[model samples]
Target chain A: MGGADIERLIALLARLPGLGPRSARRAALALLRQPQTRMLPLAQAMEQAARTVRTCSTCGNLDTHDPCGICTDSARDRGLVCVVETVGDLWALERAGVHRGVYQVLGGTLSALSGTGPDDLNLAPLLARLEEGGVREVILALGATVEGAATAHWLQDRLAGFDVPVSRVGQGVPMGGGALDVLDDGTLAAALTARKIYS
Target chain B: MGGADIERLIALLARLPGLGPRSARRAALALLRQPQTRMLPLAQAMEQAARTVRTCSTCGNLDTHDPCGICTDSARDRGLVCVVETVGDLWALERAGVHRGVYQVLGGTLSALSGTGPDDLNLAPLLARLEEGGVREVILALGATVEGAATAHWLQDRLAGFDVPVSRVGQGVPMGGGALDVLDDGTLAAALTARKIYS
Candidate 1:
């Protein structure tokens, strides 16, 4: 229904995480409908990002700089590192403004079904960071999924030789989550087991 | 959490249909993660499409050519033209492979709430196509909505001066649709009204 260029655009857009072939066509049409305002700018932005963005050598995070802003930021506590499964997770922690520390992006978790071993993740830089030896704590901020837990256990075992302490993010009832009826079995169990005393 | 270029890419992606800020960020990260394979090609495709694709003069459909492929195709019947609300609708018809005629994209339908009137649509080109003559039937293949019906009525009235016959696509129970119990009231009524006689 469109030229090869438009078809190619749609096909490439379909490769994105959330977009499929149909929505990619819709997105392409929406872009074509407003070339000056949407298409050109998006093209320019993609081109710019593609040209400049690179993975950080120090922490496996993505940024234009080699060390990344987080790695170079003196104000943030480099001694307190948060290990996450992906760059998206790192962004989530940053967005919440809950972590005033540096981050290590593992790219992905160790999944047995997917044949993802410890070697598949960005573990070398993490070990290098630990070997440098000023880090007080390494917080595993991975997901609550099975693979996340497996990855955390693997990392904990690997980091046992180091002087730094290893800890996983607490699992319990979410801060703003609904009552017990809505809570899943595992979450309710964790919440009960981790119950704290009143002041 | 990222460089300026990455931020710009995410912001631009968020402007697309069916994508919000969070999904856009995820998309950006996906693109950034595979710059060589995904991001560069997508950017190139968008740039090429932006530079080449334009609205067809004969129809309102978008293509690299002036008159579009459908309008110029010798195999198709020029005497039969399908008037649709958008290029997306034209694509839908083409995907169905049920139409052997050319198309006239109206760009959009008339809407009172959105203040979209006849002047806002691509009616002039359609009239010009009719004035040039040889069109036997002008099929209204618009949506089954209030605005679509209103636009069809408006177009029918405007085309009263033309010699060509005007007809609308049939309204009935959809092909491969679910049981009658699941049909909405309007659809059920329409189906009943447009019921076919048994052979």
Candidate 2:
């Protein structure tokens, strides 16, 4: 039905995170249908990104520059650093427009089953940043999962020697959550435990 | 959080059939993570397909060659031509491996609401192929929709001038479909109407 090139394109597209074989084929066909407008531009963009995009040495964020924009930005508070498990999490925080400080991407969390230890993450650079001083506070914004808790605990133990204060993001009912009846047991418990007093 | 190239890649990817902005960003990040293994090869494949693929003049199928591999293949029966609405349909039939005949891709069906007409389809090459003679059968393997029926009727009216016999693919219960209770009214009607003779 198709030539080798088209077959290869479909196969490669199938390797992406959400795309499977059928969807990849559909995407390939959609791209092929408009070669000049869609396929060429996408190919050029991918090529350009592949050639230029690199990981930031300071914060483990991905950008074309070594230090990344957030690391080099003077306006953002360097004294307050938010530690996230992945770049995706950092992007999520940035999208929310709440964080006015820099980020340290751990790349991944520690997992016993996956054999991911503290060394597997970007902890060395984070420690180096802490050792350089001037950082006033460190915020652990990791997930609510067991691996996230384990990673945060390990980081807390390591950062105890430093002069900077460490804190974890508050856990409770989310901003747009529904009624307590619809909430899960863990979330309900967290919300009850972390309840604030009325004025 | 990303540069122009990465943003451009995400935007372009978001235009694909099943992907949205968030998924596209995930895909872009996945690609960027392994530039050597995933991104470069996909880019190269897209470029190659874009540069080499062309529409087959004879059958309207996409291939690197002029007439396409199916049209030029001596093993397939040239006397039986399966007319399909798109190259994707042709690929589907080919994947089934039930058809020993060649194909004629109509590119799209006739639609009054969308302003698609006979002139907009690949009817010229089809008529030309019929006029060249030796065509025993013309099978309409279009979708089971109003547009497909309209297109089939139009083709039947046009092929009235030709000597070849025109037929449509059967409409009935699918291969792996469940009981009659689960089937929709249209499909049930189709199945009952097209019921075969019991041995």
Candidate 3:
């Protein structure tokens, strides 16, 4: 029936995380054998999501509506804004359900290796929006990579004297446990170098 | 834009392979932020594939057509049939590019725990198909699990006194491996007991 079609399906699935050609082939076959009732709804969902989902014009977050629900919401604190390198990071913060403010997705961090810079980031617009909307605090929630650190520094410099309290998210290993085995050698070294004596 | 939509998107993406709520949330955010050209086409492809794909009536493979391409192919060796528990397994064999025979999908192995049996499987239909066709051999490409072994034995008993030869796929760990170092005592013992002298 759909030899070429199945091939196409496998190709698409292979692109997803943790799916190699072997697993993709397997998943496709399972889908093929499934009844229409099961398959159709999934298909519809995929179509609907694809057709309607769009980015928030204000903060570069994904949404079906402009400005997004968070931005439009009155309950959230308008003065506190979290800045992240990607929309994915924003979603993670959202799922944690801890933050009460809106977000600014920078699209990506400044990377010297990748030729990414301050201007390349959509930060100017975010800054402008902050100024226009009277934002008080900007929380940088970027990855703990070199690029991320560089970006945080860049943003700090850019927003200097703007009357906004710029704070970077905590870096290094987790706390309140035994020795941090998960912390990288560099972070561990840094932590050791900046260690404080207990009373 | 997609504040409420984030929940729905996360749920949907979590259902996909290798994506937990954490990963799904990230993916949704990524999609929301950029909505790039790559994303639109990928989404469209996903939708189109989902909309058209269906099960093959003759062989239980997924396809846009009813009989499926494999079943309809005149060039394939229909007499040498490979029996598999799932369409996914069949696809794995196809990916290996080793076999040129048609396939018989058992749907699942017999499991007393799950209350699955010969009747629960498509065995009757398979037997009928065998009777109606020119099948000379049935290759069991089932898993190495206990149920998979029992199913093979059951099939052997059912096809007693038949002319066709029943064979199983070879059992062993994949290449670039040594279980003697990593396997538990029981599995290592079993592997050693079942070891064959390869020339």
Candidate 3, residues A56-107, lDDT tens digits: the string is 7878777777777888899998788899987667767886797999888898
Between prediction 2 and prediction 3, the one with superior DockQ is: 2
lDDT of 3 by residue, B3-52 (tens): 44456656765766565776666555545444454345445555566667
**Can you write out model 2's per-residue Cα lDDT over A1-199, one digit (the tens) per residue?**
7789888999999989889999998999999999999999998999999999999999999898989989999999999999999888988998898999999999999999999987889988878888898889999999988899899999999899997899999988888787778888887888899999999
Q: What would the per-residue lDDT of candidate 1 be over residues B1-199, giving only the tens digit for each residue?
A: 8878888899999989978999999999999988889988998888899889999988899999988988889999988989999999999999899999999998999999999988999878778778988889999999999999999999899998997899999998998897989889999999999989999
Off by over 4 Å in 3: A33-38, A176-178, A189-199, B33-52, B172-174, B179-199
DockQ of each: 0.80, 0.78, 0.43
Alpha-carbon RMSD to native, per candidate: 1.7, 1.6, 3.3
Model 3 chain A, TM-score vs. native: 0.88
* Candidate ordering by DockQ (highest first): 1, 2, 3
Question: Best lDDT goes to which candidate?
Answer: 2
Candidates' TM-scores? 0.95, 0.96, 0.85
Docking class of 2: medium
Q: Candidate 2 DockQ score?
A: 0.78
Off by over 4 Å in 2: A177-184, B179-182
Across residues B1-199, which tens digit of lDDT does each residue of candidate 2 receive?
A: 8777778999999998879999998998899999989999998999999999999999988898888999999999999999999999998899889889988899999999999988889988778888989889999999988899899999999898997899999998888887778878887898889989989
Per-model C-alpha lDDT, please? Answer: 0.90, 0.91, 0.72
What candidate 2 keeps of the native contacts, as a fraction, is: 0.69
- Where's the lowest-lDDT run of ten residues in candidate 1 chain B? B122-131
